[model samples]
Target: MLIAQVTDIHLGFDPDNPAEFNRKRLDQVLRHLNEIRPRPDMLLVTGDIVDRGDAESYRRLSVALGQVNFPVWPCLGNHDQRENFAKWFPEIPFVDGFCQYEVEAGPLRLLVLDTLDEGRHGGAFCEVRAAWLNARLAEQTDRPTVIVMHHPPVEVGIEWMNTDPAEPWVDVFRQCIKGKSQIISVICGHLHRAITCQWEGTTIAICPSTAPQVALDLTPIDAEAPDNRSMIIADPPAFALHWWNGSQLVTHFDNADEHVMLAKFDKGMQPLVRSLMKERPGAE
Candidate 1:
């Protein structure tokens, strides 16, 4: 099974206009996905779908995602408004104010977790949500499962960004995932940069954003300095392709410009031409 993951779209950020930097970046990502030789089985948008908690943003997101041909699953991020999201995406499954859902693709099970805390940068899974996760894990203890969330459970080394107050929620998540050999990986995307770490014997992968990337700075910035110190670089948009072959999950980071070709080539002379090029002008 092939699954494509795109995150941190930040749509509807510019309310008065249709064209915004983040929206255009999202369009690029969608275009890349649409042109793939073989489309993925499903597309997962981890979170940060909008910059602000507004109904209009959610409406725009719904319309934009309508272009996708495969199944699209979304989870709430810190910038998202749950009520607005639910109103626009009424088809999405949610329980006890948490957008947690399970889907079975062949022999693999996907567990989507909601860690949004409404008006904060970090995330948390409350008691109700934790119980839901535990119950789901117990029910499918025999099947290979992959947990998807917005905020990563482990720290990403960047000291300031690591100040998320969701540290308390890690224990609950650990308790549920520990001793579960069936779990293949924990996939997340909040830190706008590709990051990976190990937690409870499971691999945690934080995907890069499809928009402008966050600058990889470890310094603690001065509070008096303007918010400009936060991010940097307008990187090319990208996404992750996860291949589940029943036993192990292999991931490939795909960029829109991944394809490059040699203009001129002869099938039989290719190796001879390369060997000739390596030889000296008069020593061949």
Candidate 2:
């Protein structure tokens, strides 16, 4: 099974204009995913669907999402309003006032989580939500499960955007999934950059945003001082592809823009390709 993911679209960044930059970037990515060979089985929009949570923005978002042909599953982000989102995306059920649910994808069980603490910059998982997750985890201890959420728990050293390790919510989340061997990976977004780390004996894969990307500077920033620094950049829009090959869930990050071809499989490269294939363990 192949899963395509696009995050932090921020479609209403320029609500007045019909041709907004973020919207264009999202369209570029959706077009590529829609036309790519072996089309993705589903698309996961990992939060921040709009810059401001508004009914008009959601309406526009719904129109933009119509370009894709695959199933789209979205969670909530700090920038999202649950009331407005529920109105626009009625298909997604909100359980107990939380946008959380489970999706059966081929052989894998996807636990889509709600990490949005509206009006706050960070994530939140209350005891109620944690209890729900615990119950779900207990249901099938042997099934390969993937937790999909908006915020990644680890701090990535981008001082301004890092998730505080001492936060109460992080502790709750840690306790909920600790020692769960069935969880193979946790797919997340909201960092606006592609990052992976080993946490709680599983992999946390963060997909880059379709909107502008955060600058890759790790230097500490002083709030009082106004030092000119690159905070955000218009890097080419990005996405992630997760391939489930029975035992492992391999993830790949990519940009949605066109790239210059440096190599091709032609008569000159045919011999190299053949030789590489023959070196595989079970080459025919």
Candidate 3:
């Protein structure tokens, strides 16, 4: 099973400009996905589909998403408003008002969780969301499941983007999933960068934003000198592809923009390629 994840679209960044930067970046991502090798079984638009969570932004987003050739599942981010998002994505399986549900694809089960806490930048998993996740995790102990959400449960070192692990919501989340071996990984976005770390006994993979990536600054933010800090940067739009090759799941991060190849696969590399790909006499 191959799953593609693209996040932090922030489509309506410039509310008035029709040809906005975010829209262009998002289009580039979708086009790249449509033409990439090994088409994804489904796409997960992790979160931050729009900037302000306005109706028009969602309207534009919904239309753009229709062009994808595969299924696209999206959850909410801090920037998304439930009411506005529902207007465009009414079919989302929202349980008890949160966009959290379990989806079964060929060899993997995905639990899309809503970590959006309205009017806040950080993430939160309230009692309702936490309880639901615990029950779901308990029910499906056999499948190699991946818990999907917007915010990274563990601190990512970016002082501004990191979430307090001791926060009440995060605490509850850790308590429920700690030591649970069934979960293969926790995939998320919100830091706006491709980050990987170990959390609670499993791996956590964070996808980069499609719009603009957050600058990788590990220094503590000095409140008095906020202007001196590096925040957002216009890096290449990117996404993550998660591949489950029967036994293990491997993830790769790639940019939407076409790469500038330094060498051709013709003449010079043919023998090397053949040697690597050709079957050995003793192999399966």
Best-fitting candidate, measured by TM-score? 2
Off by over 4 Å in 2: none
Candidate 1: residue 164 Cα off by (Å): 5.1
- Model 3 stretches with alpha carbons more than 4 Å out: 278-284
Per residue, candidate 1 scores C-alpha lDDT tens digits across 1-284 of 89999998888777778787777788778878887867888899999998887998888888888888899988888888889999999999998878999977777899999999877788887789989988999997888899999988887767666734358787777788999988989999888888877888888888888867788988766667756665657777778888887688887776555567755578777998788787968765
Candidate 1 vs 3: which has more TM-score: 3
lDDT of 2 by residue, 22-141 (tens): 989999999999998789999999999898999889999999898899899999888999999999999997888999999989999999999999999899999999999999999999
**C-alpha local distance difference test of each model:** 0.84, 0.94, 0.91
Error of 1 at 177 (Å): 1.0
**Higher-lDDT candidate of 1 and 2:** 2
Clashes of 3: 0
What is the full ranking by TM-score, best candidate first?
2, 3, 1
For residues 1-284, write the lDDT of model 3, one tens digit per residue.
89999999998889999999999998899999998888999999989999999999999999999989999999999999999999899989889999998888888999999999999998989999989999998897878999899988989888878888888988888987887888898999998999999888999999999989999988788767756766889899999999998877798999987689899999899988888766777644
**Which residue pairs in model 2 clash with each other?**
none
TM-score of each: 0.88, 0.99, 0.96
- Name the candidate that leads on lDDT: 2
Q: List the residue pairs that clash in candidate 3.
A: none
